[model samples]
Target: MIFLSMLRLMVHDGFSLTDATPYRHLVSGLQYLSLTCPDISFTVKKLSQFMHSPSKTHCQALKRLLHYLKCTISFGPHLCRHPSHHLYAFFDADWAGDRDDRKSKTGYVVYLGGNLIS
Candidate 1:
């Protein structure tokens, strides 16, 4: 759904789907995908490095991603209503975790009033 949403956005802006493939713009695109489809963020980011030179396997993987989106259309995040207004956050990082680049992975999520807005 995340990729599809990006595809939708570009198409809505009058760009042809094929030509709109923004593999060249993975950083921003993947960040948007993280927000729109948090469940797939990790996997999406893992695959992002190959954007500049995507292989047939990558194309097939993207197609599978689209299929997963279609199958899970009804799933979505739900923020419960509550009276508390406290803000809470959780974060984790693994330094030099990427096998290929030895770059660290940083992940975080914040909640305000029991709602995760970031």
Candidate 2:
């Protein structure tokens, strides 16, 4: 209720939350928020862990997220429309990287349509 009212106030007063979801923009927001708003970092990081099944706490964290969005509403990705189309990818892994479970850290990305699909 308070969050919705605050956001209504922000939007009515000309603020918005449209540009905060792009990958790079989100990373930057988290970084800035981590440093400038340490009070929210732990909440935000825990939210990241459950990105798949976000809880009410996660929703609250996101509502609070508007502060950062309100502050950085101007930010977004800038991509050249005429970049090369040749696809390229790099993979990395540290075998048995997890000391506790002896699990590996594997990563890969596929660029099929000018976007990282995997």
Candidate 3:
């Protein structure tokens, strides 16, 4: 699930539309999974935007995400028992990065004692 920074997904990229049922189901489940697997949160969010009418490319991306998850099933965040009192936050924004909609995208993550909290 390595998304290139320059990759831009469009609603109509000449690829045929795919069945929405399975895509919707997988995206929904991935939404829940994102709670524990923050690494895929951004990808899942991007994929969910096409739920109403997912293109073949979107379906392929979803499959690739699933494969990545399968291969990294054993990896997960570990919380320390005795965490430090330090709190850290980081964020970045892509100004008008969405080529299709020209909308800016931003994301942030918060950590407490080196453990991701948000």
Task: Tell me, by lDDT, which candidate is best.
Answer: 3
Model 3 per-residue lDDT at 65: 88
- lDDT: worst 10-residue window of model 1: 7-16
Q: Could you give candidate 2's per-residue lDDT for residues 1-118 as a string of tens digits? A: 2233222221122223343344334544676676655545654564455344434444445656766557766654334554657676879999998999999999887664465534
Badly placed stretches (over 4 Å) of model 2 are 1-60, 74-76, 110-118
lDDT of 2 at 6: 26
Model 2: number of backbone collisions: 0
Q: How does residue 88 of candidate 1 score in lDDT?
A: 92
Best-performing candidate as measured by TM-score: 3
RMSD of each: 9.3, 13.4, 6.5
Each candidate: what lDDT? 0.63, 0.53, 0.83
Weakest 10 consecutive residues of candidate 3 by summed lDDT: 1-10
Clash statistics: count for each candidate: 0, 0, 0
Candidate 1: residue pairs that collide: none
Tell me the tens digit of each residue's lDDT in model 3 across 22-93.
889999999999988878889889889888788888888888889989999988777776548788999999
lDDT of 1 by residue, 1-118 (tens): 3554433221123222353255446444656867787787765764565555555455555567657767988887578998999999999999999999999999998988878878
